[model samples]
Target chain A: MTAHTSSSSSLGLISSATAISQGAEAKVYYASLHPAPSPASTTETVDVLIKHRFHKGYRHPSLDNSLTKSRVAGEARALIRCLRCGVHVPGIRMVDAAEGVLALEWIDGKSVRFLLGGGAEGEEEEAADSEDSDVAEAAAQEDDTDPLSEYGATQDELMAMVGAEIAKMHRGDVVHGDLTTSNMMLRHPRSEKGLQLVLIDFGLAYTSTLVEDKAVDLYVLERAFASTHPASEPLFASVLRAYQAGMGREWTAISKRLDDVRLRGRKRSMVG
Target chain B: METYHYPSFPADASHVHIALFKNVSNAAELRSRIVRASLLEGSEGDLEREAVNFAFIDARLICSRVHLQTAIYQAVLAHAQGALRTKTVHSEILWTLNPSNNISEAIRRYGVSDTTAFLIVVRISTANDANVLANMQAVVSGELSRFSLEGITDWASVKKYYKLNSEPALKIQGITLVQERKIIDEIVTSTVAMKSVMT
Candidate 1:
């Protein structure tokens, strides 16, 4: 077993890469990972995303503690399961349940949210500046639409990627409690030929075979779409189409269950 | 020998050594033996120290290299992120093997035991890859005389400690005993890498 023992004092946490993405229960930071030395390896530069489950102020102490710990643990476990089942979920690089943080392989492309004009203002500016450079480099290549739009993936295609990946995850009995376009990234591969449509943020994931849980998972994504991007019904439908193909027979019950969930809302009516 | 790698660190982490021993039968004996050895007097103490420098993991709880790697990687990251509970990365491995935060207890229980066959010993350094490779070869073939590619494992103790009498990772999975050992080796190896950031 090869071991690494860099003192925390030695590793200067590069603040430049510490871009934070505030989730509902956590704040994620894009950071650098110090690569372990290898024989064939030449360089030591790597980037990773650190999902920090920030302490919640409203919840009771004990409940908050366990919830944070379990959620972090659950996310780590789900990622491992996804890897085993051959889903392209990012590999787990590090976890700190106590600190309520998880470090994962960072994808080097824009999130689906940013690609669709939902990214933060600062990133949007950077994206715009990158586009300005691209245009200035070649006036002949001056495309009217933004450069990110030139990635050539329609909204429908991105949604299908989300659906297929989620279906594969569900098939492995992992239920993502929260799924949104913001949580998914369209990594335009480091190279021209790279896989895209990566689903992330498994903090709320759980291992379950309950039909209700899976249905609820899809329902949550549906609601996320309706709220985040208006008139996205057609785009979401395409996602479901791909999801159905990946799910096969399992889609029938889940699709019906999703309708029931939608009617009742995310919180199932206990009155009945 | 099984090789493990964690690409998220510096260049030295690419080299890994792992070996798995299935059906560890004498866990109790190994436990007692480790305990007794720790209490031994004079030369016995030195012999025990030299003999037990590896970790004795319960193979049952381990799912895969990725599973173990995540755990190790997390520990390393914890330290790199300035959150190590223990004082060193080596101790961090012991920290991870235990569920709670008792440092001494973790070291004694999970560090090394008597019937431990599923032993993974890793020596990590930031030296050149050629030196690292040479060190690994020297350690396995020279200083560690008891270790062998075919022989030097105590499987019975591993099974007993891990309670691997029934675990899906070991049972339901379509892998041979040799393959199981390889998997175990990788997990242990990854555990070592993650410990780098401990303390």
Candidate 2:
């Protein structure tokens, strides 16, 4: 804790930010870049999400610093690659590699997991629901109407967006190592193209053009769906169908590889 | 003209003033002066350097306001951390804008050229000096206008410089002009912001 406390000066700008979540690697915060304007003022200021990777008390300070720096650099690089490839990910706003802080465009919306009814069952979600009226509205609104329709998309349509976006990213040779429903988001109603799905959290993302890697990427998401959603087999099937269409000629090889992956699991045999 | 104050930056290096100059007739002279300022020595050199302290960017190569802002932000970050690859923060902005690492190549491509018709002049200073704008106007013989990024971009050069013609993102079908420009701007801005980490 002292290791992290000493480095808090590096995150001085984010001192005023609202702490959003705490993962093992980084602490996420929601903040506005500029001072909040007066209520009547029309000045446009976008909010940002700051991901601060604090020091670990257990690791050697020198080793921790290098690892933190590289990870920050790697995540920023992957996000930039996705942006250039036209994948809908958060645009980077600012970076301080030494401080291990990466500030990104704040996405305003609910995670796909929350939209799909999986989030309501969690204790974390219950606490989050009580704290944020907006999240509560999203959850309550979904229960009252067609759950997926609030985003202007059916369940099938939302699955297709997830598939198409991932395919676009794979086409750019960037593999998202972690692909769960929670990592995907639908933009809020006020934004342009409100229904558009955005992929987030590139901390584990890397550049890999291998068909094996791409298949494994999809398989991770497929397993996540199975574990989290009821009657998810058909939902995962629909995602694959859209992904096949988006990949075009490249789909055949990846689809075949995905079948092989399902049979043998994610890892290749080491005995051979 | 627009003045941006970055709250996160140190007090001495927070304010940034940007101005767009169009219909410039002395680009060749300004370019030569910048080159000459680098070689001067002692007190005489200090006076010359102060006269042209701002970053004179080729406005045609800029895709949008965010694109320039991203470069400025990254350059300022590098300056603050003492990790600048170039001598000054102003020149570092030009280095970040270019795709490659060659310093001279970056300057040649993004800096004011003999044929540059429009320019974006930026001054990063401690105080919001009232005379900064006046000084910029006095140096460049051109008509100063509001720093609006619309209608001033040269997309063809941007494509050529970034080598976007071969990129799959830009080659996709049925992408509208507006959509294409938006993609380009986002990519360029992201590239500038992440240049330090770029492999």
CA lDDT of every candidate: 0.59, 0.84
Q: Note the chain A TM-score of all models in turn.
A: 0.77, 0.88
Model 1, which residues run further than 4 Å from truth? A1-17, A35-41, A55-64, A119-143, A146-152, A191-193, B1-121, B124-199
DockQ of 1: 0.13
Error of 2 at A68 (Å): 1.2
Docking class of 2: acceptable
Two-chain DockQ for model 2: 0.39
Name the runs in model 2 displaced over 4 angstroms. Answer: A1-10, A34-42, A120-143, B128-130
Q: What lDDT tens digits, residue by residue, belong to model 1 across residues A6-101?
A: 322112232334756564777768875554333333233445787777668788867887887777777777766665454556655555565565
Top candidate, metric TM-score: 2
Which is the leading candidate under DockQ?
A: 2
Model number with the top lDDT: 2
Candidate 2 lDDT by residue in tens digits, B83-194 = 8899999999999999999999999999999999899999988865779878998889998886766788999889888888888778768988997887787778777877
TM-score of 2: 0.90
